[model samples]
Target: MTVTFSLPPALEARTPAEPRDGVRLMVSRGTSVSHHRFTELPHLLDPGDLLVVNNSGTLPAALQTLDGVLVHVSTSQPDGSWLVELRDTDIARTGLRLRVPEGSLTLLRPFTSRLWVAAADVPGDRVSYLTRHGRAIRYSYTDRDWPIETYQNVYATVPGSAEMPSAGRPLTGAVLAALAGQGVLVAPITLHTGVASAEVDEPPYPEWFRIPPSTAGLISHVRASGGRVIAVGTTVVRALETGTGEGWTDLVISPDHPIRVVDGLLTGLHEPRASHLMMLTAVAGEDALRESYTEALREHYLWHEFGDVHLLLR
Candidate 1:
């Protein structure tokens, strides 16, 4: 699958969309498409439809080294080592120690081409340490730094994701109330997302996810009752389609590996050649996805975490 358009820098959403209650939403069902405000999302769904959203919180995972290089903390390994990305450089040497604000990190070895295993320490818990010294991760598309609060969703509670589960960013309390009033079921699953390799467009690594039996039961009931199980982000899709209650997931959804659980998706616009486009293809079909992207680009829809969203229903 090839995406033929280039993303203009001006189309990048440099800041959070104002007033989270509404934003541009492109709804695609088959090869058909329509534009609507995100607040109209409830109207687009049937009474029994279920919207599965990821409640994993964003961590202020971007930290600066003593020399001012940025580090993206990806995950805490079970053995007390941390998996991190040295964002300022393309290569890392093992046994190199870099001094951080609170402490220092000693690179143990390579975890991936862009990530390394390291030992990290601070005054207290990792979260607390980050709260004091870290900032939200951003790329060149953003013009300036924004508060960490802007990187969070209204309902986020679990603190783990290196970046925000941004598809849920525009959902507000008002929207949730409206969905409930319209009899649309909303369920939460916790999926701790690791740092994204946006530069490389690499396949995602395993991340922790938890779908309680209650949400699992809701999925089963919705499917049996002729309702669509709509995932709010690729994170939720990965968690639900893995068909597990709680664990780390390395599942990669593509056209060849059919998606069994999700019937629809609400997600941000993915970049051309992103691994995420493969997952979107699984739910929306290749032609529909291609059409949607072409329309989005033509319509000047914003891209990235703070951008507008796309809804794909099967």
Candidate 2:
């Protein structure tokens, strides 16, 4: 099914919400839809529900060449090479190696096709190099560059994601405390997200993820007790549904697939025709997703990483 809509620039959020938890949330359950402040999420969920969050921390993935060209570090290969995208340079074909500034050399490869394999000559480690020189990846929708902290969720731990698992960004300490006080369970998994510029029809690339034994146990217990497992982001959904273990996953959740682990989703408001929309449709049903997106647009809800959220329940 083709789902398309025009996203006005005015509705794109340019900065993080003032209180983080001050963002708006649109909830969809079956045919019903409601709106509330993000802080009210604890009240919306039942006491026995389990909230699974992605704890993969965002990385400063943008690097600049001495010649003033920008390169985006998209993903890390298992062999220690990096998948990188050049901002403005053009390459005619694959199998070509180009020398970048700052002593880095990039080889055009077929992995992901759009990104080249990059290796830096001067680096203690990829993390160390990125920490010293890279900046957070931003798009034209963002008015200006913001600090990496602005993109991180309150529960971030394992530093790996190329981009923020943004659905959990509005979950502040106060909100988490409130949920815990009400007896809601929270679990953490890790899914290091790659760059987010996939073509509309392109499938997702493999990304590293780990579902800890503790988290896996909690999910099993929650399921046995009839508690809903609410995934805080698409990354968490991908990790849990794919299985409880550490590995690279290229699992794509779309309308053709049935989700087995995630009972609900709390995610950022995605634009129409986005790949994420396909995942949303799989969870919320196509008709419900359409209604929810229509309502979000009509209410002028924000979109993107620093935007409003949607809670879709079964």
Candidate 3:
């Protein structure tokens, strides 16, 4: 199905909501749609429901090469290397080596011709090297530079993701406490997201993920007790659906696929024709998904990482 809509430039949120939970939330239960503040999430859920969140923290993945060109570190390879996306120019080829003050970088292979697998000649761990030199990756849509903390969720713990699991951004401490007071269980799984691609309909690349035995057991128990397993983000859904204890996932959720684990999804308003729209369709069904988007657009809901949220319940 071809889903398209006009996302006005004014609707792109330049910064996060001041109270965080002040963001608008569009709730879609089957074909029914309702509006509420993100703070009302607890009231919308049943007592026995389980909310699964991604605890993987954001990483400062953007760094400059010797020539001052920007390179975004997308994913960390099993080896010490990293999958990187070179911006502006296209000189990043197989076996191309770049010299930097921190270390030398050797391009291994092209991840997508624009992105390449490259290794840095650092003495210490790659994470440490990046921590010392890198800055958080930002798109042109984001008006100004913000700290990495701005990209983090309230429950973020593990450090791995190149970008924030932004769907959970509106979940403040008060919201979490409210959900807990309502007897809703919360759990965490890790999925280190890579740099988001602008290429439409492209499948997600393989990324490291870990679903602990405790979280898995909780999911099974929730299912057995007839509780809805609400995924906080697409990253959480990807991790829980494909991960055991630890592994890499290339699972692509589409309309053709059946969602076996997640019963609901809390996500941001994705762009029209974006790959994420297909995943939303898998959870809410196409008609509901379309209606929700139309409502969001009509109501002038913000879009992107720092925008409003949509909760799709089945």
Candidate 4:
């Protein structure tokens, strides 16, 4: 989908999506479009459709250097270094030492245009260190700082994500109960999200993910029984497509890649140039994606992590 449009400031969801069920859900199947309240999600899916959710908790991973530059610790590398992004600053270079309240991180090399490999000298576990000294990462689209709880989904358990797996943000306890009563199934995947891409030119960094054996079996069973496998977020889509139990996934689900798992996606609206758009295209096709975004913009649907959601079903 090559369509693009201006994002007026009024349409950016600047705060938390509280009363998550109250948010709008735009459902798109092929070129057909419909709108409903997010609480109605249970009725949208058929019986036995499996909804795979990401349970990786959001981390307050944004810390400040001694010079006040923001460092977003994204993911930990296998070699014990961390992948991190330095926001709104240009002093980063190889061998650079970023000092924080807890410890210092020495930059090793460029992982991406905005991210660098850094060795952490913080005390205790990385999660605890970040918990004690860091705060939630926010982009310029947001109006003000919000608490970490606001970024987290109701079902998040494993703590690792630098940012929230926001597609599951609208899943309220009420909706979960309704889905269960409706005979829809739910499963879990752990994909710790890294920081989002701020530039269109940059691709996403590799993320750590784990797909439990039970969840994998459920996906196959549900599909064989004529049920759809619906991914709650792009994180779940990425994790499930890796075809492995646990590992770092570098898979970028563009139209070039085959959609091996998810038959539908429940996700938040993305920015104009966001790479997640490509993944949506892979699922819904280019024409459907093009038409859906055009309609979403015309209807004044909000965008961003705290915004309204888009359900792309095949």
Index of the highest-TM-score prediction: 4
The whole-model lDDT of each prediction reads 0.89, 0.85, 0.87, 0.90
Per-residue lDDT over 136-211 for candidate 4, one digit per residue giving the tens place of the 0 to 100 score: 9988889888999998999999999999999999899999999999999999999999888555455677889999
What is the clash tally of candidate 3?
0
Worst 10 residues of 4 by lDDT: 197-206
TM-score per candidate, in order?
A: 0.97, 0.95, 0.96, 0.98
Model 1 pairs in collision = none
Assess candidate 3 and give its lDDT.
Answer: 0.87
RMSD of 2: 1.7
Error of 2 at 154 (Å): 1.1
Candidate 4 residue pairs in clash (backbone atoms < 3 Å): none
The candidate with the higher TM-score, 3 or 4, is 4
- Deviation from native of the Cα of residue 283 in model 3, angstroms: 1.0
For residue 197, model 4's alpha carbon misses the true position, in angstroms, by 3.6
RMSD of each: 1.3, 1.7, 1.3, 1.1
Residue 298 lDDT in candidate 3: 91
Candidate 3 local Cα displacement, residue 53, angstroms: 0.4
Candidate 2 vs candidate 3, TM-score winner: 3
Error of 2 at 240 (Å): 0.7
